[model samples]
Target: MFDSIQWLIGIIKSIRINDIIDILIVATIIYYLLKFIIGTRGWQILIGLFILLSIWLVAKILHLPTIEWIFDNLWSIGIFILIVVFQPEIRRGLAKLGERGLFRYSLISKKKAIDEIIRAATFLAERKIGALIVFERNIDLENYTEGCVKLNAEISLELLISIFIPQTPLHDGAVIIRDQEVVSARCFLPLTINPNIPKNIGTRHRAGIGISEETDAVALIVSEERGEISLAVDGKLFRDLDPLTLRKKLIEVLEIEKPDFIGKLKNKLFGKKKWKK
Candidate 1:
């Protein structure tokens, strides 16, 4: 143990400034990669890979030729195997990096987008209109929105409400929102296959939860039967939220700055209500 400590100290002392920066960059990449994959099936795959690595180590120690050979061949194709297994995660990560770079100079207002969504959801809930709105984060949702009407228009309260109004042509499916734009309407989202979900929840809510489970997107659901608002993210559901709670939740998830007292007061003076807690 003392010898190991000495070796570590020597390595630390020998590290130059550039070496330290390189280490920091690599560490940052690994940290974000782990964070992005956490709470997803990618985490399970990581655990399986770790177990296989341990088994390979044991096989090498025991001179088990067959096991060692199998693991060696596996490692040879590991990069391709990982790409296949983690296709969604890789795509999402790349999308996030590309979006950040492209939108760095853009004047997109996330606050306005959140406000529009909250206003539309509140309007729908008051009238007991069922609506599902999926807010895309990093993941590309094009695969799931193939047949939906392509709008690519700026998001607005009126536009959202009109799309979900009862008897409307696009009322049945979900609205896909990306970067403050209404990407599509009547988009069919994936339904959650979890058996634990209650049977009473309708198809709209199920799809809301489903898309959230499969991607990093957030889903806002307004129920027609109960006239309630709900939020779904990371496969977890927050049900029966009031308007204030919904707004706060969205701001938190979207990493928007909280509204100041005057802004909050103005909203309350208008149609929004203040939640005590």
Candidate 2:
């Protein structure tokens, strides 16, 4: 016990201020990275990896040569695993990082794109046209875009409206928007696997739930029947939001800016009452 106490004291003494700062910085980066990947399939794979790592450590300590050897081989093939398992996330992370340094160039481009999308959504809402718009942030949707017509065009309200017009070729499918560009139209997204979803929720809503469940993408669904706007994130849906509310919520979820308490207070006092109507 005395020896162990002395060893602990020695280790503690060796840890300098720089070490604490380094640890904090690393921890903060990891926290945000995990936050970005939360609710995605990558999270499950990460959990599995942690379990495997724990087992490997136990095996190493226990002198289990066979188990250690297997883990060593697996570590050697980790590059391939990353390529296959986290392809979408890897692409997105790279895209986000690229955008950071060239903010000025991308700002106007993104603003124009967002404006067109807002216009399109408003038009659909006014006409009671159902639409599903999935906006990519730091994640690629190429795999999800399979079987869909690739537009790869600059986003415009008119184009969005045209695609989702009833009985049109792309009317029944989801549209994927990335970097202020419409990458694809009429793409089929996965349906939610959750059994507890309400029976009344239709296919479009289910698809929104599923896609959000699997990725960090935000789903905007405009109901054709009720003309209600719903936002889905992390596999959960917030229904019956108005245009302004939707925009605010989207900005919040996207982490575009820090929340302003005064603005929030004002909104709570005024916006809620107005929305109640």
Candidate 3:
């Protein structure tokens, strides 16, 4: 016990500031990794892998030759197997890691996605259809997809409009669009508990504002009572925007490739002056 205590003391003494930082970085990564993996499909896969790893360690300790030999052989291709099994998660993790810099581009046209959403919102607004569309931005909204219908379909005016047609199966909840794909529909977002929100805005708008508060995502809402388009971002809601204005707002927040000098000049010369407020 004295020897063990001395060894522990030595280890504690040997840990420098650099060591502490290194340990902190690793612990932060593991903490976030576990936080992200929990409640995801990959969580079960992780549990299975852990059980297999535990079995391998147990086999070695118990002198189980057959199991040990099998796992030893399997370990050779284990990395490749893992890559295949966790392909989606790995890709998302890498994309998320590099999203602020290198991997910022989406598979689909950002402008096109926004346009489709605008068209759908216009269609919904004209008929007094209430809608909530959340666009995933720098932050991942994967947690919202749970218990929701996973469409995984490309975003389109028809699809977005159909989902919110009154009395439709998915009409009750918000739609989450990530990149150019409508990741899920009928997603129940956390509602803001703040009483400061105007009484005129309903549950749909509240949900849109709620998600924006928690993430960097931008939300487009169609007010059924007023038949106006609104945007919510950073916990604040902007109400009563036209199509052109909404487009500008989405492009601005989403950080899409900004208009060049020529386009800006065109806007200045010919296009309707960008709307304010």
- Candidate that would win on lDDT: 3
Weakest ten-residue segment in model 3 by summed lDDT: 99-108
Q: What's the true lDDT of residue 60 in model 1? A: 95
Q: Per-residue lDDT of 186-237 in model 2, one digit per residue for the tens?
A: 9999999899888888889999989999888999998888888788888898
List candidate 3 stretches off by more than 4 Å. Answer: 1-88, 91-108, 259-277
lDDT, candidate 3, 1-277, per-residue tens? 9999999999999989999999999998898787656655677788999999999999999999999999999999999998898888888777767754443666668788889899999999999999999998756688888899999888889999899999899998889987788989999999987789988779888999999988888999998898999999888888889898888888888878667899789868897444444
- Name the regions of candidate 1 deviating beyond 4 angstroms: 1-15, 39-44, 83-96, 99-106, 126-128, 135-154, 176-218, 225-242, 253-277
**Candidate 1 residues 1-277, lDDT tens each?**
9999999999989989999899999998888787677766688799999999999999999999999999999999999999999998889778868866623743458887888899999999999999999988766676777889999888889999989988889898999987778989989988999898889988988999999999888999999999999998888788999877888888877657766899788768894543332
Give the Cα error of residue 47 in candidate 3, in Å. Answer: 21
lDDT score for residue 34 of model 3: 76
- Tell me the lDDT of model 1 at 69: 90
49, model 2: CA deviation in Å? Answer: 4.9
Model 3, CA-based lDDT? 0.86
